[model samples]
Target: MNIKEASSRLGISARAIRFYEEKGLIQPAKQSSNGYRTYTENDIWRLQTIAALREIGMSLQDITHALAEIDQGNQQGLEEYLELQQAVMYAQWVELKRMMDTTQRMMDLNRQDGSLDVSHLHELAGSARRLREARQNWHDRWNYDQQAAIHDQRVQAGKTKEDKPFSLYHNYDEALEQTVQWISPVSGEAGLDIGTGTGNLAGRMLNQSAVMTGMDQSREMLRTCRRKYPQMHVKLGNFLALPFADHSFDFVVSSFAFHHLGPEQQQLALEEIQRVLKASGTSRICLTDLMFTDSAHRDAYSRYAATTGDAEQQRALRERHFPLLGELCNWLGYLGYETKHIRHNELLHTVLAVPRP
Candidate 1:
């Protein structure tokens, strides 16, 4: 069978079959008379298997290894490959089930509370938009390599800790003050500090809490946190999926990490935080993230954006460079938390989110 027939039989594009050929995964018999490629039923079977594996989330490298094992007369290897596939499918099924359950619960809550406070409705919608902006701005634009480069450049420049692009250094004193203001400060209960970038707050605030656990997604940050606060507990993990049990924490606080997530994931993290907090638990937000109302910052960041990409990408880049206060208030409201913006001289905004009565 020629390329056309092979593609027709496999229900894939001829270009795709050619791509597989380039990958050395498939080779067709060469016809000398017209220099045409020809395939057989066996080739068709191989293509079908490749397609099936790809559909089931197997990487091309994995499929290539499986094919190599088959060519080596290792038939039993197929069983192992199938077992790996089953494991992947099972994990995906579990994730899908969780998503479905969450969506169903959201729907039920929506139906149960047709009288949603206008403030709450606006808060949720605005928060979703802010979350979308954050993902597009910060986390999506920043790859692992970019993060490393930024870290190295800051080090090479001998930049002061205060000169760091995003730092919680200045927020430590204010954070401690806020903790003291908590209506009923729990001084001896376990707490988890999400996004504990430098552990500055964790170290200072640990004295106020019995057991303080600091978790950050960045290993480099965690390394710094560990060295700075040897007695504190620090782990690397995403805020959206904390590795703790429900009601495991007496208080959960994040120092400037919430804006990195997409809106939905932000809410998911908030919900998870609420779940992990004991009844009447408290959360304090000292968002070091900034948004530029200053024309100089706007101009400087604008030039930075233009050098990178299109206007859309530029604005996204700038958004990551700053945080918005009103948007933060909306996010707190959506999560059913009361918010009060603390007056501060620094660009960072402080808000507190407490469970609704």
Candidate 2:
């Protein structure tokens, strides 16, 4: 039969048959006289098998390799191929089960309050789970020796404020101006700036509040803060595992740092914030990163992020910085913080969440 006849009989498109040929899964019988392609029952069976395997997620390379082995009269090839497909199917089934389990849990959360749906709860659970994992990893990896090495590295980098082309900070400053304008900072007893890079917020709070503490994981960053704002108390710490006691601060704020972490880290940090803030305290987390609308920002941000790290570490470093706003919000809410305000205007996006009073 001709290619068209075989394709019509199989109830598959001619285009798909051509694609299978391109992938080296099936070869049409070549004709010499008019150079017309011919298809036999063997080819039809092969195409059907290929289509079935593809529907079950067999990759092009695997299909092609298996076809070659089968053509070479290797009887075990078909068995091996089936086994590979079975393994993939099992893995997919496992993932589907996990998704269903998560979905069921979400339904329960939503049943408690009809305001949230599946997507919202899924995001929350995923974020919270990831946070626990990251915290566990950090606890396992951190030791006195690692801390000493980090401290030494901080000392070696030296507190030099060179002209680094960081667009994040520039955008952050713009956002901060707009945020402070709309909601005036009502002075509280004390405030904490979690992950206070360069002490920008802490610097602003120094004069405005009774006492302000800048908390960051990087000693180098705290050193920079110490140089610029001697009055504000700076401590090296992680947001996920804050060092302060419960109800330690009246107000907690983080600027453009939450997205650096995955959903898990953000939620853990949120729970930590909830644990530490006063009952009536407020928390504002300012997020200044690429929005869902800003496609160009990722390329620019990625290229610029490369300069901050050595060549060996640039790719991983860039991956760490970029995150979507929706995921960030889902994490915040899942960790039990009420999202009071969310603003995304121009290129800056900010979210403010307060613990339940």
Candidate 3:
């Protein structure tokens, strides 16, 4: 096969194959008459091996050394090299996951406030150093730590007070109540809650005998959560990349947290959700947050916010990538989830998504 055919078969770009060739990773047969390279079976196998290693986050130098070991038939050397590379990739995965969380946080900030100020840059710089500290591994844009201190209190308070000009939860307590009600939990079944700040949503399910593990990026929030329920398993994690294994849970749930991610990030979170959910046809995901019914609702909300002259409302409109119900369902459906929309009000929505039988 020529480079084009090999590239097509490998599903990698032609440029990448040429670059690999330049690195001496693989030597293909060259026609004497024209000096054109033609990939043989051995060459294709080497190329495939190189691509696999690279996919696992190997460097070019590392790959070259690994391939050299194989060429020399040094099985012991190749094993050691692979073991070392595995450790390196594991560390890289942790750091990369942290960086991805931080990047999404900044993207969310830029989306919400319409600009990232000098203060934002300073925060980002400080966050790099803070990553060494607990809870700093993932920096939440909304400062959930501060919110964690009073999250439940605020929700309870909203229940009794006059309605605010704008709130992420149309009815805070009601949203949670409905979201928890919608989630059908079987006794002893494993469940995970992403962005499970203070264990509010998971707490209700736990009462029903669901084996719940709550995960959040905020350390302070998790601390409060542990205080509330010392026995429950809790971890510091974000939605973009769930820390659990594939098909680990019977169900996953979250509330008032999904909007923390941008649209693309939301899709990424859903991908993680689908991975962690069991292949059992009954496995499902339940999430509640401020969202639009559709594009028309989003447009009308913008006009309503503008007319109200509430900067907070206007800012909320701009800052929040409030998901559209139809779009979210479409994303869920693409990932093999059948969805049911439960609208709490004009702005708040609960999506109950389950695997299609």
Give the winner by TM-score.
Answer: 3
For each candidate in the order shown, give its overall lDDT on alpha carbons: 0.63, 0.62, 0.79
Q: If candidate 2 were superposed on the true structure by all CA atoms, what would the RMSD be? A: 20.0
lDDT of 1 by residue, 230-340 (tens): 789876555655656567776777655666665466655666677667765354433333344355755776676577555544555544544455655676788777766
Stretches > 4 Å off in candidate 3: 1-139, 160-163
Give me candidate 1's TM-score against the actual structure: 0.50
Instruction: Please report the TM-score between candidate 2 and the true structure.
Output: 0.47
For 1-357, candidate 2 gives per-residue lDDT tens digits of 987898889988999888877867788888999888899888989988788878878888888877777789875556556555654454344334445777687767878844756677768678646544676554312233344334434423422324533333334455655545433456655778877766766677665654888876654566667778878877656666666666787777776566566555555566677767776645444444434323465567566656675442354344454455555566767766666444444334666665555
Choose 2 or 3, whichever is better by lDDT.
3
Candidate 2 residue spans exceeding 4 A from truth: 1-132, 136-166, 179-183, 281-317, 340-347, 355-357
Candidate 3, TM-score vs. the true structure?
Answer: 0.62
The digit string of per-residue lDDT tens for model 3 on 1-357 reads 999899999998989999998888887889999999999989889999999989977789988888999999987556555655654544456557667877787777778755567688669857754543422233366787778888877767655425567755457777777777777788998989888888988898898899999988776788788899877888766876576667899999998788877776687678778878888888889888888888988898798888888776787777667888899999999988889987777788888998888
- The candidate that wins on lDDT is 3
